[model samples]
Each structure stands twice: as structure tokens, then as C-alpha cells.
Target: MAQDSARQAPAAPAAPARALLASFLPALAVGIGSSVLYLLMSGLAERLQEVLWGPLPDALGIGPYSAVWILVMLTATGVLVGLVVWKAPGHAGPDPATLGLTAVPLPVGTLPGLAIAAMLMLAGGPSLGPENPIIGVNVALAFWLGHRLAPRAPGPLWPLLAEAGTIGALFGTPVAAALVVSEALAGRPMRGALWDNLFAPLTAGAAGAMTTSLIAHPTFDLGLPPLGHPGWADLLAAVVIACAGALLGLTAVYAFPHVHRAFSRLGHPMLALPLGGLVLGGLGVLGGHLTLFKGLSEVKELAHDPGGWTAGQFAGMAVVKLAALLVAASCGFRGGRIFPSVFIGAALGLAAHALVPGVPETLGIAAGVLGMLLAITRQGWVSLFTAAVLVASPTIIALLCVASLPAWLLVTGRPQMQLKEDGTAIR
Candidate 1:
């Protein structure tokens, strides 16, 4: 009887295996879907910009009428917001400051709406971020499919897990996505559901990372040397740099909510959004044409060609860009701030590089990203990873991690903004 009982008993760690598979499969799916959707939406957004702005440049020739571009972007964005509010209610993704690390598992039906609207917003050049839409659509789809496939699966949580997993995979890092998810789910209990969350994101991260590796060797240029070898001076400088970064980040996080609220008070997106475009247009004139839109192209340019703009130019651009982005976002423009944030960081780095001659400009830029991320997201780990990844050097990441500690600490201690209700912010 004892032998029979022993034989019948589970011999292996079924939970672990199951857990692994559970997380992996959903994450992979999320990665695939995210990758495909990201490419599609990004392409669409890019093409839209070309179509919208193609003619104006030729008309201006040498001294392009950049003002028109900004106006057009604002106009387009306003229209997109109008469409979203009218056609796809609740398509606005999470509010970043208020929604750090939180995930509301949206219905599957909502995914299509969210995706389309999100694409429109992004294409229109809003001051939002892409991560929310990407995660939202992924989760929405996962829930729909999961419900259909496993009618007996757990509540809304399962779909959420799958979405989170997909995010993990799409991000090429499970932990960052997990951090984002955890932040999104803040104030909620994770007891008995921890394993489930872990499984999905891990699997998704692996698949996404693998896919990313195959398609594009993603590297984040956070200028730092390899781990275990950061010079003492570098360490000291990093600490100082981190402190500066944290302050900026905190400011950004706190201020952005207020900015959003200001725009929210305008009542209708149609009227308010056009005004935002005008503001953005003015900013474009001040910040230069590159500061318009998502700012991804700008970040790349800053990283590769620092000479493109001088120190004075960079500083001016940063200030202008920040205002433009704030106005654009508040006015109901669609798109993400991730790239713009990075651009802001890069601009800061460039400014810092001019001041601190010896240090690699990349490092300063990276530190800026770290600070901004920390301020924007209370997620220290994600901030660290994001700061490190942009440099695409693991050594730099390690070094930057150590270097940016002081700033993280300072920023972490400051007050943060929280969302109270629809378009409401509570400090």
C-alpha cells in the first residue's frame, strides 16, 4: 500500500513545469502580436506623417515652413482624438503618472478599438506612450482567445496574465514588463496569483527577446563601462548625475499630471486640441522641426550625430520640446512620450556633455534617461534597465546602474502623482 501510494504520488515538480509553460506560451504570443502590431502601427504612423507633411517641405525649400508641419500635426492629432472619443470610447490607455505599474485587463472587444485609436493617436503625434496600448491590445486579445479556448480558466486574471506575458516578451525583458504590470496592479493583492503572473511574462519575454534577437539586435545606448570595473571618478560622477536625473524625472512626473488636468478642463477635445497644435507649432519653431512628433528619430540622431546640434541649440530645444510635448499630450494628441522622453534625456546629456567635457556624452545622456524614467515611473528596476539598455552595452548598463544610484534615491523619496478618476489627478 505504501509503495503504491508513493508510485501514485507526483514524482516531479509539476507546478514549476506548468508554471513555466503557462508563462512562456502567453508571453511568446504577446511578443509575436506586439512585434507585428508595433511594426504595423509604427509604419502606419510614419507613413501618415509623410503624407501629411510631404508637400510643405518642398514648398518652403531651404528654410522649410516647419511651422506648418507643427500645425498640421496638431490638427491631425486633434481630429484623431475627436475620432477616438466619438468612435472608441475608453480607448485612452492608462495615464502614465497615475498608472505606474498598473494593468486593467480590458475586454477583448476593446482591444481592436484601443489598437486602432492608439494607432491613430500615435500617428497623429500625441504626447502619450506606446507601452500602454501595446499591453492593452495584447491583454484584450489574450483574454478573448483564452476565454474561447479554456472556458473553465480563471477569472479576468488569466487574460491579464497573458497580456502581461506578451508585454514581457515584447519588451525583450520580462522583469521590466512585470514591474510595469505590478505598478499597474498597485494596491491590489497578488497572493495566489504571483506564480501565474510570473509564468506568462517570463515566457513572453523569452519569446519576444528571441524574436527581437532574430529580427533586430536591440541595443540601448546607456553610456557606461562594464560591471566590476567602473572607475572611482566615474562612480562619483554617476552618483552626481543620478541626483540630477532624479530631480528632472520627479518634476516631469508631477507636472505632467497637472498638464493633463489643465487640458482636461478645456472640455471638448476638438476645440482644445487645435489650440494644443498651435502651442506645439510655436514650440516647433522654437525647438526646431526635429522636436515635433514622437521624437524617436531625434533620439537616434542625437545618439549617432551629436554634432547635429550645438550645446546652446540642444538646451533651447529641450525646453521647447518639453513644452510642446506637454501641450500636445494635454490637448488630446495621440502618440507616446517614451521616445520623446528619451530625446529629452539625450538633449540633457548633450547639454551636460558640453559642461562636463571629459565624460562620454552618451553617459550623461543615459543618466538623463535614468533620471527621467525614475521620475516618470516609480519603477526603479525599469528605470535602471531603460537607462542601461539605450546604450546597448551591458558594461555601460552596469556602470550606469551604479552611477545613477544617488539620483534614484533622491527621486524615489519625492512625492508622486496618482489618478483619482477619469481625467482626474491627485497628488
Candidate 2:
């Protein structure tokens, strides 16, 4: 989904040589610093999850992930997160409903509480992801410390580097970071050649990516049976499933504001978040544990045992997870929609295969992820990257490329899953 070279270039002069060179050192520092922060935040969440789901439950003599435990932990998490957002400095950095993944950095003092809220949601089984808040924290820290350390560097350089680095760490690759940065740069008047502009950010991204790979060995491969080649039918199925997934995601995109407004009417996170958690508890009971959490592991579980659930069950999980994502985002949770959207796509793809054994599983999955991501994020390259990465089959790329066109057509110009300052959903 890289734009053609002609389109990427802008009719503008190159950046001043001195400023560009000054940016590199700080860019490298920002990249590494941001990724380390990402790891610390995510690691803390994982450890907390272990304690919450492991020894505490074992000590209490309750079955792990029992219905009661799910409800209790999630409700407690909501109450705790509510207290932070209610009373903490800067109210945990604004309602997530009003921001996209790319947002102005929060103040430095606000980041600690925001990180805590995000960790709670991650460990507490809300259908959300760490991407947004992690990026926000990283951006804030980078901007604050980076400016002081490299005062002569361009002001915009540090946060952009941190954003690229954090995204690279999140996806375990630099290409995602490159694509996202490129997308952001596409319309603005540019300086220098494309690569000149990209050099520092890409360097930071590579560093961040390598750091995560060496430390966590992160990956997206779902271990699905591979498809050797695709046919006309596969192409058609890809288009159909991509569109279907877009529609599925559209349900949430369309519902976001109404839901946000509903919770906003409740007048406080103390009231709204706990009640949202209760509603999410009901969803957990219906969708089971597979529909909970940030959804990376849950999606892997679904992919591993697609045969374990019936088609109806898969469909139900997809719908319920979508609802869970909507609720979590609309009701004061500090998390992102992408991972849960990934889960919904995987579940919908599995449901497609279950309904029609004729369709290739890989095709169903790539198209599903493509459609769902396109609808949710409204970004083409990352959506394509995510879908193709999960299947880990280069042969599926041609089909995904074609499928994304129709899916993109369906999602273009619609209200995004994110809300505007006036609270209407818009991209």
C-alpha cells in the first residue's frame, strides 16, 4: 500500500542540512527510550495478569477464569481504573473516545496514571489493546525528555520518532512504523527526498523493532494451514469476505458515538466505567474467555482451535467481541481497538471457513482481517500488513491487495470508530 513514487513526492525544497543532521541523535534516543517504556508497561501488565489469574485464584480455591472470577476481576479493574481517571492528574489524559492512535502527547505528569489505567484494562479482560495509550505515553515522555536533551533539534522530530519506534515495537517490525509515518506525511508539504525525510524515523523504528525481537520474540503468525496458490474463486471470496468484515466493523464504527454519548450522560467515570464493566461482564459470560483481554492471545487461541467451536459459536464470538470493543472504547477505558478488531476478523474468517469448506482458510482470514482493519483504522498499509502477517503467506498478498480495494471502497468517507471534538465520529 505504499503510494506510487510520484504521489509521495511533494513540490517543496529539502530540509536544512544542519537541522536534519541534528535530529538523528535524538531520534535514535527517542526510539530506544520509547520502546523500553512500551516493554515496561506491557511487561507489568502481563505480570499483573499472571498474579490475577494464577496464585490469587489458586489461593481462593476458585477455578481459574471461572465465570465469577471474570466478573469480579473485570469489575474491580473498572473500579480501580475509574478512580484513576476520576481523581488522577489530568484525568488519565482525556477520554479515549475523543482521540485516535495518533494524538497530541499527554503532559508528563499525566502519563503515569494513564499507564496504570491502560495496564488495568489490559490485564482485566477488556476487549482492547495497548497501542493507543502506550503510544501516547511514549510520545509524551519522548517529547518531554527529548526536547531538553536535544534542544536544537526540530521540535516535531522526537514525538514522531517515538511514535514510529513504539509502533515498530508493537508490531515487531519497522515496516509498519515506516508505513504509518509515510501515511502521516503523505499530504503535508515535504522536505527533501522521501528517504531523506524517512531516514531518522526509519532508523528509530528499526532499533525499536530489533529491541522487541531480541527481548520478546514477538510475532503475528497464526499457524493456519497454508494455501499454495490462489484462483479466481479465491479472489472473489477475498473480496466478499473483506466487504463482509468491513460491514461487521461498520456496526461498531456506526454505533460508537451513540454509545459514547450514552456513557457521557452518566456524568463521571466512577459511574460510567463500573457500569460499563458490568455490561462487559455479561458479554464475557456470553462470549466466554476467548472474547476477553487485548485479544492477541485470544485470537491465537481461536486460530489454533477453529474446529473446536461451531460456526454459530465463531459468529457469536465475532459479534460479541465487536460489542465489547465498542463498550470498552466508549466507556472510559484506556486501550485501542485494533487488537480486538483483529480477534473479530479472525473469528469471522473462521466462521466463513466453517460455513463453507470450499473457501481457502488463508483467504478467508486475510480478507477478514483486511476488511475489519480497514474499517476500524481506515489505514490501508497497516491493515494490509497486519492481515498478511497473521497468515504469514506471501502467496496471499495478491489476493489481499485486491480484496482491500473493495473493502476500502466500503469504508471510505464513513465515520471512523473514533470521535471528533464535538463528539461526532469522524476520521
Candidate 3:
């Protein structure tokens, strides 16, 4: 009887594996759920955009791409979002400028208003991505569902899983999630092996990436020249361009609080949002379509034919996009700043290439993106990954890594782009 019991008992070492396998199913479900939610939210916004910019304008007899229509649509979008924030449940959660990528799960009741506001921002040409708000919604939904469906699951694990899943879906790759989460979790002491904690999140990220891929493929490729063998000249140019981009990003960082304070002084969403919309509209008028939206497509457009634009034009686009980003963020638009910063960096890099003539287009762009992202995100690994991913050139990776050293130094002790609860800089 004793021998039989011993044979039946599970080995202690197998516990980790068993736990990981057990967590996998819930993680996968959460990932898929997050992706589904993302798709639904994005789809709704896309349809609304079509209506606002396409059929509605045509029906009203306004030219589809008219600046007047753009102005009207953006201003109206701000008003609608403001109304939701003012009257909707939970006041749309919290000010996005005060939040980061991760936060405590919000109440399920707040999701509706948050979703509405985010959708409006997306469709309205805000210079922000859907990452921040969508991640909050996903985390809340995942936690709520987990409690009902899997009572035994750890409470803390749900947020991590949800964040990983949403990040994977956002970038359409698990690698980005891994890098970001790893960077966030680095230096924090934990009980288990790092990989052990990472297993569930990675599983979730993979599921999310696969699910998002079924609906649409995410591509950052700009079709730039392949970064070939790097010479001494290329390295020198990379550092110079990277520093330049970092300086520009720092300028925005310094101006962010002032701009945010200016908008907040209105003391009412109704007053603040419309005024912000007006400023953004004016910026759009100055910068044209290339400076609109979250900037993914616009970055690609700018890179497609770098020679088509003058140095002055590229500089103008960068400045205008940075301004749009600041205004959209401060005015209660719920979105992420990464995409807009990436766009600004790309434009700055193109301008550098135009002026220097010595820097390769791909190298200059990678360096510029690295520097700006470093300043904006304050994450070296994520910044490096973002810059290298744009060109997908192995030759540029070494150059980017080296250039990031100086860029990091410049931004290390500087004020971050985020704001505190009291609307002060988070320095």
C-alpha cells in the first residue's frame, strides 16, 4: 500500500511545470479576449472615420478632403468626447496624461465611457495611439472575467496577462511585449525564476499576436535602402542625428506641462476639449495630412520617397506633429504617445539625411528614432528595438546601439513626458 501511494504521488520538481501548464489556458483566453476587444474597438472607430470623412462629407456636398471639413470633424469629435467625459459613467476613468501603460484594474462600469472616448479620439485624428486606454479596458475585463471563470487563479496574474496580450496585439508581435515587459520588470525582486513568471505572459502574448494577425498584418517596414556595411562616416552621422532628435524630443518634454496646464486651466472638459481641437486643427492646416492621426501610415509615407521633400518641409512636419501630439495628449484624448514620437523622429531623420548628404537614409532614420524614443519612453531596450525594427536592417543595429548611448545620457536625468496627478511634470 505504501509503495503504491509513493508511485502515485507527483514529484515535487514537476510542480512548476504543472503550474505553468495550468496557467496557460487562462492566459490564452485572456490574450484572445484582449485581441477581440481591440479589434472591436478599432473596427468601430474605422467605421466612424469612414462616416465622418467619407459618406457624411460627400452627402453634405463638402469635398471629402477639404480642410474645412477636417477642421469641423476634429472640433466636433473633441466636443463629443468631452460630453462623454463630463456626463458618462466613471468620468472616463482618469486623465490619460497622468497614467502609464500599466495601472490597477479599473471598474468594469467605467469601460463604456472609456471605450466611447477612445473611439472618438481614434476616429477624430488625434495624434495618439489606442494603447493606454485599451490596455486599461482589457485588464479590467480580464480581471472581471477571471474572477467568475477561474476562481483559483492568482489576482495579480490577470493584469500581467492582459497587459502582455494587449501589447502583443498592439504591435502584432510577441517580441515587443517581451521586451517591454522585461524592461518594466527588470530589477524588481520576485520569488520565482524570471522565465517562470514570464511563461504565462509570453503564452498570452503569442496568442494575442496570432489572433491579431488573423484580422490584419502589422508592418513597420518603410522600404528604405538596405543598410549595408557601416563605415566610419555612417557612425559619426548617426550620433549627430540621434542627438538632434533627442533635443527635439526634449523640447516637447519641456513644453508638455505648460501646454497641459494651459488646457487644464479651462477647468471644464467642454471648454478645454474644443479649444484643444481648434489648436490641433490649425496645426493640421499647417502640416497637412502627413501630420495627422497616430502617424504609423504617415511615417511610411514620409519614408517611401525621402527625396520628394525638402529639408525645410521635413522640419516643418516634425514640429507640427510634435505640437499635435502635445495638444491631443493634454486635451484628454486617450491614447499613447509612442506612435506620434516615432513619426516625428522619422521626419527629423529624413531632414538630417537631406541636409547632410553623408548619412545613409536608413542609418539616419534608425538613429533618429532611437534617440526620440529614448527621450519619450525612457526605455533603452524598447527604444532600440523600435528603431531597429523600422528598417529591419542588421547592419544598422550596431550603429543604433552605439548612438543610443549618447541619447540615453542626454535624457537620463531629464523630466519624463508623463504628468503627475496634480498636473506637474513627473521629474
TM-score of each: 0.82, 0.95, 0.94
Comparing 1 and 3 by lDDT, which wins? 3
Better of 1 and 2 by lDDT: 2
Judge candidate 1 against the unseen true structure and give its global Cα lDDT, from 0 to 1: 0.62
Off by over 4 Å in 2: 1-21
Error of 3 at 246 (Å): 1.4
Error of 2 at 74 (Å): 1.3
Q: Assess the local accuracy of residue 121 in candidate 2 as a C-alpha lDDT between 0 and 100.
A: 90
Clashes of 3: 0
Candidate 3's C-alpha runs over 4 A off are 1-14
lDDT tens digits, residue span 324-384, model 1? 6566555655444555667776777777777676656767777777776666555677777
- Best by lDDT, which number? 2
Q: Tell me how far the alpha carbon of residue 137 in candidate 3 is from the true structure, in angstroms, after superposition.
A: 0.9
Ranking by lDDT: 2, 3, 1
Pitting candidate 1 against candidate 3, the one with the higher TM-score is 3
Q: Which ten-residue region of model 1 has the weakest summed lDDT?
A: 93-102
For residues 85-104, write the lDDT of model 2, one tens digit per residue: 99889889978987766768
